[model samples]
Target: MTIRLRLAALCAAALVLTGCGAVITSPDQVTPEVYVEQPSVSPAAAKRFGDDKAEQAYQEVTKFALEQAFPEAFLDPAKKTYTAAELTAGVAPHLTPTAAQGWSSLVTLALAGDADAQDSLRILQFYNVDDPGSELPPDGDVLVRQQITDATVDVEEPSGDSPERLLVSFRHEAVLAYAEAGRPYELDVTKTMSYWLAPAGANAGSTWLIASYDGRMDVAVDS
Candidate 1:
């Protein structure tokens, strides 16, 4: 069988063995419970932004990190396990298959309601850079700083008695960091991602949903 076919089969087998139910379920079913509400920012602090839009943007930013960025970063083998090339060549296919074996492990994870898988999907759906810069970090000790500079949203007005719909645009900045061996270094990276919240209707709750998220890093250095 071709690589694509083999990958697909593996995915299908995994799904069956894991009892994930469906290969392409909606996001609502997969999202964790923690992302349902706005994050806390003190009223006095929030007033510095001076607008409801800013408040909404802040909420969306935190929500994206928790519900989308964290999960994607955790489960993505390119980011976590394999190199980027291996991911493209060895694991890119198998989203669908003619036989039961055609499902990929990522698909299985996604269908199985794995929180990490859900987060990965959320990040791809929401966070993207128009021009992704170089992946390599600079040589020598250096600290990187990143921040979000701008954002915008298009909200659809609710009909008769429905909730609003939302479309968002976000932007950010990043600074590279480099350090010598046996030296301590700190780097801070900020990201901004947008989201589209469909109007709340009878079937709306069944649509893509993100409830909450927590971000943590497990760091290990290899010699």
Candidate 2:
């Protein structure tokens, strides 16, 4: 059977055995690869707003803000908005107030499409995860830095064969290690994240969000 078929079967089996013993898949089991491509931004828009550098910065910041503010299961039922208070409460106990403020600032700038927003967002995205207490290198970076693994951009043509809509896919993986105070140990994890970006508002700016993420804990050792 095809990998996609196998994966679908696996998912169905998982649902069926929801309350039963653990479902198992062998190492040789096939898995399908997913790909998403990024669409090209209009040259006129790029020139009027800013260069590639500016756009990249904006995307980075927005991603950071969304990641920090929108934790798992924090979506408001009525409005479907991710509450800032819920985010602050969950992270505040573990991070310094300054750090929290930094995260908030990153999100704000990203929403505004500011150039400097990306750098700030990048920092927050690196650290906000299942484990936040990991110590970093001497420079205090928590995420493993790696090159882009997969990317694709999809452009849709309008009814009259005119290019009107665009979709960008970005995916990457990183190795991260960190240690915490009070605990005599260090932890390592490998994480992969992907996002999709599309034009936002009636203007040239773009809005993006997390499409998916897979995180796995590797090891914990005494520091």
Candidate 3:
């Protein structure tokens, strides 16, 4: 007998082959493989600047911010909740102190079941990964995974009123895949966001931190 399995993920404009197939004669012959796709950055934004140094910087910061702020879906079916500290720490490295504090409060309110907070953070969409009500399968691991399919990072130079400030924007398309009983289910998501960044300290070598942000995210799921 021959068995074939293929897992593909989109990274920017390139297609990434995440998992390969294996031929098995017996059911117990091989262990099942879990599909995972980490976020990826595109070079399209860097091309806008027309500078090699700027291109490198854009890719570096964009990837760093994505990993720090918007992480992939949770693959562990046993986990259900996130603490305020956990959520805050996940975003602290890329945000200013005040921004981090605000995010902490947001998570606190969401954890308490505040409807508005939940809506603002949009956590309930994929929170219950193991819910059977969604007609999830019972035999294999029920996991939720995400792939950053396409992404762009744009930078705006400081001018006029905000002479020293820099604006960085990230726009990305992602696919959220839910594997229920080992079957892949998918959803489409797109997010556009901008961050106002300033130096964390007065020193020239000080790192830039996100002071404020505005963004929108839309998810497309079956009706």
Summarize candidate 3's per-residue lDDT along 133-209 as a digit string, tens digits.
Answer: 34433533332322232334445555674434344555544444545466666545555555555556654232566
Clashes in each model (backbone N, CA, C under 3 Å)? 14, 11, 0
lDDT of 2 at 163: 26
Model 2 segments more than 4 A misplaced: 1-139, 156-165, 180-196, 202-223
What's the true lDDT of residue 175 in model 2?
A: 32
Task: Compare candidates 1 and 2 on lDDT and give the better one.
Answer: 2
The local distance difference test score of model 2 is: 0.33
- Of the candidates numbered 1 and 2, which has the greater TM-score value? 2
- Candidate 1 lDDT over 1-223, as tens digits, reads 1111001112233332111112221225443223223334334434543346445555544343333332332332224233333322321221112211322344446546655543343233221211122122334322222233344544445568434534444443233242334343333333444443432225432322222111222222221
**lDDT measured at residue 69 in model 3 versus the true structure, 0 to 100:** 32
lDDT by residue (tens digit), candidate 2, 129-208: 33345333454443332222333334334447322333333333333434556443333322223222223334423343
Rank by TM-score, descending? 3, 2, 1
lDDT of residue 125 for candidate 1: 27
Clashing pairs in 3: none
What is the alpha-carbon lDDT of model 3 when measured against the actual structure? 0.44
lDDT of 3 at 24: 26
